[model samples]
Target: MVIGDGILTPCISDSIVWISAAILVGLFMVQRFGAGKVGYTFAPILCIWFLFISGIGVYNFIKYDPTVLKALNPKYIIDYFKRNSLDAWISLGGVILATTGAEALFADLGHFSVWSIQISMCCVVYPSITIAYIGQASFLRKNNDLVGDTFYKSIPGPVYWPMFVVSVLAAIIASQSLISDFLHNPTIPLSRVLPLCEIVHTSPKYAGQVYVPEVNYILMLACLGVTLGFRTTAKIGNAFGIAVVFVMSITSCLLVLIMIMVWKSSLLYIIGYVVVIGFVELIYLSSVLYKFKEGGYLPLAFATILMAIMLLWNYVYKRKYYYELNNKISPERLKEIATNEKICRIPGLAMFYSELVQGIPPIFEHYVKNVPAMHSVLIFVSKKSLPISSIPVEERFLFRRIDTDGVNVYRCVARYGYRDARSEEEPFEKILIERLKDFIREDLAVNEGERLEAVAREIEVLDQACFSGVVYLIGESEVVAKQGSNLVKKIVIDQAYNFMKKNLRQSNMMLDIPHARMLKVGMIYEL
Candidate 1:
């Protein structure tokens, strides 16, 4: 209804849907190149866009009716509400569309400073948008018949083509901003072998730059479906309006809590903010929801499905964590492994991956019970993310040696910051081995003759094992709900969660974890 149709381009016929679908596919295809590069390319075009809109706005305002500025007073708001009553309230559904991408400006703040966004919003965005709308209203007064194409139709013919090109770019950028934030919620489960940090990390220079292929393609499909389904900007705008006001409403509530708990602001100030901003957003939300059947339900439906999955996953995640913690191998089990006559010691190094931070995971017990063999040089690797931005290189690996009667068993806890970018398997393995050697050099280089001899022997064994090659034993856990569990628990764990696990089998190739060199130890946990 906008670009390929007469609203923006008159000659393109009814192919706006396909044109939109093409642009959307292109956007998703390029996301893997990282947002930093994409934004850098788009930034200058955006600058040109604001200038174009502002210039056109001023031109129309002056030529058509400069006197329309008189309607800017607050009294008109009161007068209009009084004259139209409920009709005026219903108009908010359309009016809210003006503020559609406002929240995305806040979401992308991590990529830019507060001052830059503030200056841009205040100096450029605010004034340009105000003037453009006013100019559009002025143009409407003179050319009322062209209300639908008021934006494109009002442009002076000489610059109309350039403005059309700018408008298309602007539209995509607007959607891209919101889609960046949309990719985070209810993220699909990733493979145990694939680190969380690698899923979206795309840029080498910027820690925040991310492009999750799973989420990006899913969003692209959704956008294309909406384009084909809605087939018109009017219906799509209805959905857009609801999403904007709904986010604003939620932001308002979150602000109050943040003010009270985080900021420790005054109650009076909170009340004032709520009364002013909260009441207005509430009105917009109520009015927009009236169009629920007319495409307003898209956001609601999307949100509902995501929320359901998140809830189910959260329940199952907690259950699985407790099960692991409760059934972890005891310290005595480590000593028994070395003493047992039937337990065979293998040649190469074995790296067992688990969720446990301290104790050995039960998967080892399950493995040993079945095979009756263990590796000569054992290293338990637990890679987990901590609640921070980035961890120092020196502090990343926490090493602890287990005194298990010459079993040469050690525990390595690899800590990562939530925002840290974990690269390929080779780098990860290289770093861990270096850090392990460093640990031995620092802790085991004692003055005792026996201790020194033991340290030398241990290093020799490690070298021999590494030369023989290494195997990664990652646990493939299956969580089944206990018979005594409730209906929801059973449904969530055995049905919804299990189904997601099965289908969410991402290729370990992305992480460079060679499937041939890795062995998955299967374990069933009834939680």
Candidate 2:
């Protein structure tokens, strides 16, 4: 909408709206090629935007209203509030838009260094925005008739067209940052935090730089819908203001928690921080809330829907994890089953993908109990998510032998960082086999003199068996309400959870396992 307004002011054409939509669609369409390709192009344009605005601000500040500088004094703010209390407070909703890109700067910290951001904001962004606002106030003081389009009308005739072009470019660049953050940030309940799309990391150097084709198209369609629906920048600005204030208020609350828990700050410092920031945010929040009937309800409605989805997913996942924790079989039980002579031993290898790092998964026990037979080599592989950016290759897999009985049973834990890419080129089975081979070689080397011949023969037999075939077993578990449960539990577990599970990507597809050699052990969990 900002871009459309910019173009419409300078170009007197009936098709400007369509042109703006086309440009917005084009911006999203190029996202699949990755942000790194075009991110550098925005820097120079943004620099020019800041410089141009600062120059105009200085010119207007000197010529129109030198006395407008006195408005910066806090005394005037206090007097205005004293005279028109509620009106002054309601205008804060508009005041907060002046710092519009602050949150985006914080979100982009993963792409750039903290020092770089600090320097840019202090030297470039802060001074430019302050001067631009003062100049706009000065211009409005002299010419009240130009209040509707103060920004463009205040510009000098010679540079008006060029400034309009710059404004359009700036708007597009700002919108790009917002869309990128929405799709990339895992904390936002849009892409990674929800099962809305598959986030594919395009840059090996920067894990935060991702490309989500599904989200990109969805956002583009949404942009077009809003552009056609609202058809004016004023209504869109109201929605945008609500979104900005909500984000600021949420950030302030999260910051208070972080300072206490992560920073371990003093009580006095925490109180001071909250009092200062909380006061400002509360005023803006109230002001935006007051405008709920005038388009502010849109963002609040969207947030409510997103929050419900994230909470539902988290609830279902917790219930499933609790079930696994209670129903897991002990290692002794697995050993006894492996040692049982009555049960037949199959010829090939079986890799059971489980979530539990300790104890055998209930799916494995359920399978063997029904079949009364197990593979010659059984591996319980658990893929664990770590809290770091990337895990070292050498520390990727932790292999431990469970028993040395009739069938060689082992447990393998594969560690991955949240930011790490699960490359589809390397199948999990192939990686597991390579790690197992490495484990055998290390074992043989460690016990070179004690059981050299026995270890060599065992390695040869295991190699032949692994080469013969490998099967992947995964649990296709569903959460359901227990018998005699209440309606809410049934609706949440049996209806909502099951619906999401059926739509979300399956474990085998996510792990890149071949469908032909995969076996799904279906199970039901009543919680």
Candidate 3:
């Protein structure tokens, strides 16, 4: 029997396990919210957990016999490998399973300063884990025939329960941090900017993280299975640690490559990064090879599936966007449009805004069909939002002037925040009004401020005029007929029409009015 095998051992208690799990989950939430918010509170809890575990490790280290230190020699690893090459490799596979979540380190980098994570790893995690490993080696030395999770069972009852709980919590927080990272930080911009990157209105919130409810729940389930399915620490540890090391090694290499490309970095920086990466990779790889066959496949399979899903989802989504984006207006066409508007002949300006920056937008067809009378047009192409905000008033709503034949073609756009009292001043509808005022003041020799006020009044009057007439499109009306008039369509149309009507009235801008010839355009397809 193992020397520590008695009723006083910690493995006999279940309550400590649950407590540890709860604390770890709480800390995980802290990490998820970010250090600025909940991390401070979580720090103490994490510290306590680490201290308690570290104490146990230290106790074992101090009590162990001196002979156990021999295992630290490089010859032990070399000799063991020669004697049991296949077994060693298989054990390493298990260690690879242990480190499965190591990839999350990069993902969680945003939550804390890089310095903090590195500090925590060096000062807390690495030291404690190494101490524990050393203690395990000591325990094995005292009992050569011992197997399985005997290392954990060797602890005194007072320490056993607390350690078990700590292990459970550590596993959970490690997994959850990865999920939160993906949700909050995606890798790409949500959309393109107009003319320049500066034209982008707002930065994407989730620049590197993604939130997939299905994946989250699946991970939770898997974690629970592993917890209950295999109740021993050593068994799970062997399989769980290797994957993290592999991911870390790969990312380290990737980081080095990225730095070289970005900075044309010095050889010293390259070498330093390589050494650190190499060390961690080597350590993890060695550990994994030490324990592969028992249960390493569990985390390996989990990571494989995770990566596959991420890649496949991105591929499918990108394909759909690319298909829709393929149709675009060329630079030559824009130049031709400028020429056709007679910028040399026009009196004012023609201002334009394209919500979609990738190509000439679907709305350009509307311009071709209407062919409004204008002199010079200054087309200000603007980017589009996904579904268009419902705000009543917006600065971008101002008017713009397009130059054509020296005459000005005025085009106004309105950008609204949403359907609320605040939206009245921010509507997209005022883009045209602002542009027209500027043209009148600068080009037409009108008082800048007074002319803008007058133009606003005129826009109000024209909008009132539109109330008397109905706005309609000209060609290809057959498609709406074929789509079938269902309850959902009716409900959507009614809501949209009502929303638009309310906003237009509030802005004093109507879509159709008397004597204004409610502008008609060609067929409409999915824009």
Candidate 4:
């Protein structure tokens, strides 16, 4: 593991961090174009780099002491422990740092296809890294005094400058990939503080590449902070090793479960696998934990805080959803309100946004109670994101007319795939009106002359309403814990969740609704 520390270390400095800081800023700035484009730009450079190291490794292996090959024997691992014991055990923290950002490569599999990842890792990465390690070991053994800067000193002279540039680029690319892994202090504040919107489809071809501008900046700042704080590869390697082992151990535990529960392996085989892999991970875990005061506690703190936030968010989310579910206005109640002549019918078109898919939201009741009148053409628009990529534009609007007494009330489900960008403000209303007109034509097509006349009249009303104006009505509610709630629940809802909600993307901003024509109906949710 120690042998894989550097393909070519560039004498990363403690005193001068601005160079690294600049590289990080530049790396994160390009994230708006997404990983696919970034990958395309950097892939060739990385391939060349791997090949260079691999070639250097092979050259050094033949030229230097061939006796170093004996170190490949498994006995050396056991012998090293016997010789140094506690010191060797402590060094496992640094040794494990060789695999830094490797787990991130696996986590970032969503940015690429399965076959591409497999081919690249197997054909290029693993082989190149192994050869580079062998070469470094052979050269270091031959020139024992150059052990301090193993990778750089071992490199052939003509390739040294190129290696330095490539190494820095490699580090940048690596940290770019590591962006998805959020650290605690920065992550919590950024997420709860910044009003950043998540841009899902940064690349038209890649659905999984998410670009949050605020997150990118926060991560950049965090990288700069970490770089400025630790100031060297050796010190930061403490955190790096912990992060790597945490991922590896979790992955192994999941794999073990899969092998036992899903694969239904034999008892003896399960025991063997657990004993071997578990022991190795525990060994590294303990070593990494020893450096907790140095840096290892970073990930641990991040996990604890993130987990708490998630749990609190989820708890409130479920309760609030159910509250909306149970309190949704039934069809009969909708008809009653629509038929009520005292509830004055206004002229323009009103689109009320809601979360409930089936029935009218409780907020509708709140709106009608406070406000005496509603628009002539009412639509309960619930924007839905399906678990897929890119819903077709023509099929995006699903118009279902509600049987509200003599009123043109509709339940318009604006469906979008997860990767689909929300439609523009003007087009959204225009498309819905057009789709509603088409829906009326289709429904009345199956009816008689009187129905056809009604259809024409309805379309005329819709057109007249559109020409008058379209107003987006949404309930902007303050979510809070009920009066009788416990202190913890109150804190979760009133403090943390509310803080996040306040800073999160606004509904009008999210839906691209025009602020001039938007009416915010405020209410309170005591969950």
Error of 4 at 441 (Å): 2.4
lDDT tens per residue, model 2, 480-527: 899999999899889987897788666676665678988999888888
**lDDT, model 4:** 0.75
Candidate 4 TM-score over all chains jointly: 0.90
The predictions' CA RMSDs to the true structure, in order, are: 4.4, 4.1, 12.1, 4.3
Per-residue CA lDDT of model 1 for 235-274, tens digit only, reads 7777767777777777779889999999999889989999
Candidate 3 per-residue C-alpha lDDT over 1-527 given as tens digits, one digit per residue, 9 for 90 to 100: 00011100122123245543444334333333433334444466667677876676667667765466777789988998899977775566554543343456676565556897898888887787677666766666676576566656657688788777675555444444444553443334322210011111111232223333333343444444555565665656555455455556667778888889997999998998889878857865776655557655555666565455444434433443453356454555654665663423333323333344345444454556466432233344343322223333334444444434332333444443212222346332244445544545554447778767766664454444334332222221101212555765444333432343234222112221222422333343321
Clashes of each: 0, 0, 126, 0
TM-scores for all predictions: 0.90, 0.90, 0.56, 0.90
Q: Worst 10-residue stretch by lDDT in candidate 4? A: 1-10
Give the TM-score ranking, best first.
Answer: 4, 1, 2, 3
Indicate whether candidate 3 or candidate 4 has the larger lDDT: 4
CA-lDDT, candidates in order? 0.75, 0.75, 0.47, 0.75
TM-score of 2: 0.90
Question: Candidate 4: misplaced stretches above 4 Å?
Answer: 1-15, 180-196, 257-272, 422-426
User: Model 4 clash tally?
Assistant: 0
